[model samples]
Target: MSAVTIRAARPEDAGTVLELTRALARFIKAEDWFLATLADVERDCFGEAPRYEAWLAEVKGASAGLATLFPTYSTFKAKPCLFVDSLYVDETARGYGVGKVLMRHICQLAVERGCVRVDLNVLNWNPARSFYTGLGMQETGELGMTITGPAMRSLAGLD
Candidate 1:
């Protein structure tokens, strides 16, 4: 395999990113939950005020993987942290270290931005848990939680 190159995704790459996103959803058997559109990707990732940043991995000039992340504050540390929204490698690109390269790129970005930490959540059943552990990531012991859909609306008094 050729050396994988990682680059900040350009607006032109939005479709490729969205395609990989769907592939990831399919891989995780969550196709029904995948709902992002090209417009969403374009606006959120490449707009004037990007909600997040994305990087793409390419091997031999072909798209292979992607990672999306955003910054957040850690009041305790009084510094910024990066939360990885997703890290996915195409099936054809697995075992070629694409995921590891992307993760290292995220960490490198954190360091450059003076971030205190980098965080991400992986499903308990995901085989990538071991991959993260291998990179020295440890379980924080805090349960992940979320509120969405009608429940989210009710919390915001929109019900």
Candidate 2:
């Protein structure tokens, strides 16, 4: 096995990134909601004034995983926070420390950007929880909530 390299994703990596996203969805049994397209990724990840950033993990010159990151503000801390929207290692690459490398890269980036902290969510039933805990990530016990789709429309008085 060749050395693994973690690097910032480029616009051309949209297709591969989308594939990784689908793999993640399937792994979590949420493929039914995986409707995003390559164009959507390109537009959202590399458009003029991109809203998010992504990183790629490559092994032997092949894509192995991806990490999508974005910025979020902390009202109480009054500082910037780095939010990891997703950190997925392909099934073939799971045992090779690929996820850890991606996470460390993200953390280094957060520090460079002057972020106060880095945040990400893991599913309770997912085995990745152990991997996160092994990295010294603590559970703050804060529940993550979402108001999207129909609920979001209703909240906006569009119903």
Candidate 3:
């Protein structure tokens, strides 16, 4: 396994980050929804009022993986939580501890921000579930539901 270094992502990393995200979408069988481009990543992660924060994993000074986190509210906990919006490791870099290093840094950031917990959703078919479980993340056993597109439009009376 190669040594993996994790650090906060910069605008310059947008291109590689988009590539890794697409690769991850392919791995999770959701390539159809992998529509992000370098411009989008750069704007969303580094523009004014940034929507999220990202961490990148590098091996021998080359990007090997990345993770994006969004700030979320936990009403019950009455505090903020960190939601791992996306995580990806390059195919060639899997099993080299890149993913773990990225996750550790995210977790450390969550702690530093005084977040009550860190949360993420994993695909049922993804083998990384075990890795998260090993890191003390437990299944909530609660079904997730979402309303997007037209449903959201109708709810908001915009349609």
Candidate 4:
């Protein structure tokens, strides 16, 4: 495996980022939930109002993986944080430290931005939990709660 290079993603890399995202979704058995397309990725990640920033991992000049991050606020800390929206590595590039490089790059960016912390969510059954844990991310001991679809509609008085 070649040395993986991590850098901020450019506009031209949007398509590649989307491809990696789909590949990751498939790897995690959530291909059905993969809803992003090149158009969406380009618009949201590289458009004038860019909703997120991305970092790419290149191995021997080929895209190996990517990590997308969005700005978030920590009410308690009264500071900004980064939410890692997605991190994915190509199947062929897995276990070669591509993900680790991407993660470290993301952490470095967070620190550079003076963020209070970086946060990400992983499926409970995900095998990658160990990897995140090893990176010093502790389990908060609080289950994630959500209200969506009809539940959210009813709560919002829209149903």
lDDT of 2 by residue, 43-150 (tens): 999988888888999999999999999999899999899999888999998899999899889889888988999999988999999999999899999997888898
1 or 2: which has the higher TM-score? 1
1-159, model 4: which lDDT tens digit per residue? 989999888889888888888888887898987889889989999999999988899999988888989999999999899999888888789999998988888888889998999999888999899999988998888887777788999989998
- Pairs that collide in candidate 2 are none
Q: In terms of TM-score, how similar is model 3 to the real structure?
A: 0.93
The candidate that wins on lDDT is 1
Q: TM-score of the candidate numbered 2?
A: 0.96
lDDT for each residue of candidate 3 in 1-159, tens digit (9 for 90 to 100): 568888888888878878878888888988987778888888999888799888888998988888988999899989999999889888889887877788889888889999999999997778999988988899999876789889999999999
Question: Which candidate, 1 or 3, would have the higher lDDT against the true structure?
Answer: 1
Regions of model 2 farther than 4 Å from truth: none
Report the Cα lDDT for candidate 2. 0.91
C-alpha lDDT values of all predictions: 0.95, 0.91, 0.87, 0.89
- Enumerate residue pairs that collide in model 3: none
Candidate 4 wrongly placed segments (more than 4 Å):
none
